[model samples]
Target chain A: MNLTGWKERLFQRYLIWSCRREKIRRYLRDSLPSLPLPDPVDRRSVRVGALQVKLELCKSPIAFADLVHRRVKEAYEAGARLVVFPEYLNLLLFGMLPGIEELEKDYSTGIAAIAKNEQQEQTDVISLPDLFRFMTPAVQPLIFTTFSALAASYHLYIMAGSYTIADQGAIVNRAYLYDPKGELIGYQDKIHLLPVEEEWKIKRGKIFNVFESALGRLAMPVCMDATYFETFRILEERGAEIVMLPIANLEAYNYWLALRGIWPRVQESLLFGVKSALVGSIAGLTFTGRAGIFAPLELTSNRDGVLAEVDCFDNEALAIADLNLDSLHELRCSHPWRDHNPALYRRYFPQVYKR
Target chain B: MLVAALSLAGVDLSSINGYISGLINLLTAQKPVVAVLPAHSALALGLGVGRLNSSNTFQEASAYYFAEGTEWTSEFLNLHGLLAKELQIYLVTGNVIEKDEDLSYQTCYCLNPAGQVCCAQRQTHLTRFEQDLHLSRGDKLDLFRVGNFYTGLVIGNDARHPEVGRIMALQGADLLLHSGAIEGDQTCWQQAAGMWAQVQQNQLYAVEAQLSATIANTVFGGNPSIIAPCETTFGNTGYLARCNPGEPLLCAELDKETLSEIRNDNPLLKLLNFDAYTEICGSEPQ
Candidate 1:
């Protein structure tokens, strides 16, 4: 075998050894006793929880599981039937690698270090998509099992945020949903890619899926997908009652920029929107957003469209609110979003998109 | 470039000629490259003879408000067109243009600096009030040019539909001019659903001029403002300038460089999934 082939095999083995499942399970078992007791579930309305998770680097898979388990437990204790986490949730698994914490403190230095480690002589910077592609095989299983176990153990439905993985030689950001029985419900790939993602060669997904769950018909669209109205319109047309958005915004939190997402979408689509945010910093990129649960202004008691929201942008907190399905159904029936001129749209959308 | 938005309140339809003279004087002072007036500002003149009240039926209200017909609309357009030429600025105004005897459409007219009607966009989406008045819906979306910027116009409730603004952006519009009105207090959600969200989604500069007059027993009020993409605006608030209740005029400069930067940085339109939208549009609404 060639020397380069041997080195690649060794690197793969090291990643597998670093993310071994036994350590993660041991951490989960040890952390179980410290978790809060579950609150009695309310049968009247669907209580949803959105987590504003502070970004953290873990020393191993165990530490990542501990961070995730604690948040899941807290939401369950708060009587939340369904809980959502932020985008790039599995990207936190990078924390499990040795020396990654110091490297991630600065993006340029991290890229330099990765390039040196990978022995890429042709380029000074390593491709982020390629790095994620290599890491996916080792990390994807850990992410799935951890969320599945948490969902089943808590008897709660979970939108486990999003993971960027290599699919058919293309990187795509995909969001996953787990039912109460720990079964995989379905997944929705992000339809809109941020410019940075485009730089990393992440391909945009072509389909929007509305998954049928115990709570209701739910659609999961990651971060930038919420920036476009077509995402919500398509989901609404497909009969999605609840839309879960997982955001890891790269920009500083401005109230108006934040309004560009799920807040106005709920107003436009008349669908309940649950948004989970990843806050703090990773890879020298700062993420700031408030986790929020939004409904139509008329349905909300304050008529503000925001049902519940985290108090601050950078802090970790859970925003929980009861989604009155009956009220939503009534609003939908009355408003009936039938005014969307499909005939007018059919003219421009095809020609415009064709360009 | 400097842009201005005018909100008309307590306008007496009896002396609209005096109102237009005062408006032209105000625009001359501001000297904006473009100015936007509120929806139904010109058509309100018809309401002068037969004033609307709570007792009037839909038929009564429609007849009374549209009595002036196309001849009056032509005079109104000529008035605004001459005003645009006099000020040497692009002007956008809304009027109810009668199509034959039975049909009338809520149209937004954009008059160029040359005082010529460059483009007219009819409201594709109708409000409950417009529907009750039996207003005809417009079919095509069009764009006009203001200086170097390709601009689109949306009247009243058309701003509520994201598709209108998006199609304009797709057609290479960098600026959107909206003339709309709301009965009673404008809610936060209602405001967000208009130009603010449109600017964010389309990454374009927008000027929204709202009508703030009371006709019938209903009181109309809105905050007229100039808006831009959040990243380009001061404090990232998405508003370059917003007028208060009693304030009728707002003027602000739109930075072309900043708008280009925002669009270049994000390029959201390029990422749109057209095939998926096509499939969704083809499917029946659930």
Candidate 2:
């Protein structure tokens, strides 16, 4: 192999070794806090928890685990049957790696320097997809195990947010859903990619999956997927009752832009929408949005689509609300939305989407 | 190019001509490239005698106002055509077009600067009220070229469906004109889901004109506004200009350059996965 190839292989080997399960467990043992697991929720209606988590650099895998565990525990204690975290929550594991601190520092300084119109010596900055590709092998196992353990411990269905992993040689943003038994129910890959994701060479997912669970039909679509109505429309057509969207928006919070997602999607499809957002700054990029649970305007008591939303944009908080599936089903049946012109859509959707 | 939306409140059926003349005076000052008027602004003249919620009254009023070959339809068209020609601006407005003695369609008409009908889209999705009134549904969606923009027209509740906007965007429409009349109480969420969401999702500019007058027991109320995608608007609010109470006209410049830049950067339509949607909407046409 060439010198560059050899160097790349060596770095991958180091990452794999550093991300071993035993090392992660040892780190967690030191950093994880002991908290009592709350009794399981025994309500007729399913309560959902949306975690608006602030992006933070963790010192070790244990710190990341501790952060996730605390949020999950809080949701469980609050009697949420389903808990959702924000997209790219797995990226926090970067802090545990040996060389990422320097990279993070460089990224922050580079961004600042660019903003100030100051010239600095150029350094090779790694792209997000490449970084995730190299680190996925090491981090994927830990993410799965940690979320699986949390789901089992809390006895709650957990949408473990989204992570970029190398899938069939292409890096895809994928969201996983874990059952109360800690078993992997299903996962939905993000169908739509942002402009940055396209530039970073992240491949888009091709299919939509709606998983059947105790809390009716649930589908988890990560971030940008919710921007398009087709995502929710297709899921709703497939009998998805509740749709979970985990977003880490890379911009300042704007109420109008935020409304383009779950709020209107819920109104259009007459389905319950749960949104979990990643806020604050990390690696020179700022993410700002409020996590919220949404329903149709008629279903809401106040006739506003928002059921519950995080009060602040840039801080960590949990928004919990109960979803009455029975009422939603009734609304779906009674409403005139079922009168949608399928033939009209068939004429244009196929031709338009093909273009 | 500057586009305008008109919201009419307390419209008097007795002085419909005077109302049109006043509207023309208002538009003559702004001289927008295009002006959009709300749905049923002219046809609701029949509602002066009856309640909108009464099925028998609605049916009788619709027939008398639209299907009876009344002079109001021709007069309404002539006034709008004159406005379009005199101002040299494209006029998009909604009116009930009689198809037959038994059928009348709630249609959105696009009148070009030549005072000619360029395109007409009948409301494809009818509300419960319209269905009870026995109005015929339009079968096709169409787009027309006005000035430098390809524009699409959606009437009333037709804007509620995302499919209509998506289809128009696919047909290369950069501007969507929604002419609507909201009856009874309208919530903010309902408004957000209409043209606002359409512009954001389709990455197009939209002008929503609403009728805000009360006829009998029915009260039509909404804020008319010119909307662009949030990224292109001030404060990312997605609204360029919104009509306030006592203000019927809202005018805003539709910047093609900004829209092109936003669409180029996002390219939401180009990124749509056809294979996935095909599963929900059925297989591609042979």
* Structural similarity to truth (TM-score) of each candidate: 0.90, 0.90
Q: What's the i-RMS of each model?
A: 2.3, 3.9
**Per-residue alpha-carbon lDDT of model 1 for A311-339, expressed as tens digits?**
99998999999998878888777662226
- Clash pairs for candidate 2: none
Q: Give the Cα error of residue A231 in candidate 2, in Å.
A: 0.6
Give the candidate number with the greatest TM-score.
1
| Docking level of model 2 | acceptable
Highest-DockQ candidate = 1
Residues B2-116, candidate 1, lDDT per residue (tens digit)? 9999887544456667667778778888899999988767655545533333224434544565554566677778888888898898999765665745767878899988899
Off by over 4 Å in 1: A1-8, A14-44, A105-127, A336-338, B10-12, B48-63, B66-75, B100-102, B113-115, B280-284
CA error at residue A36 for candidate 1, angstroms: 15
User: Which residues of candidate 2, in runs, are more than 4 Å off?
Assistant: A1-44, A109-122, A336-338, B48-75, B100-104, B282-286
What is every candidate's C-alpha DockQ against the true complex, given to 2 decimals? Answer: 0.55, 0.46
Q: Candidate 2 residues A192-224, lDDT tens each?
A: 887667756678888889898988899998888
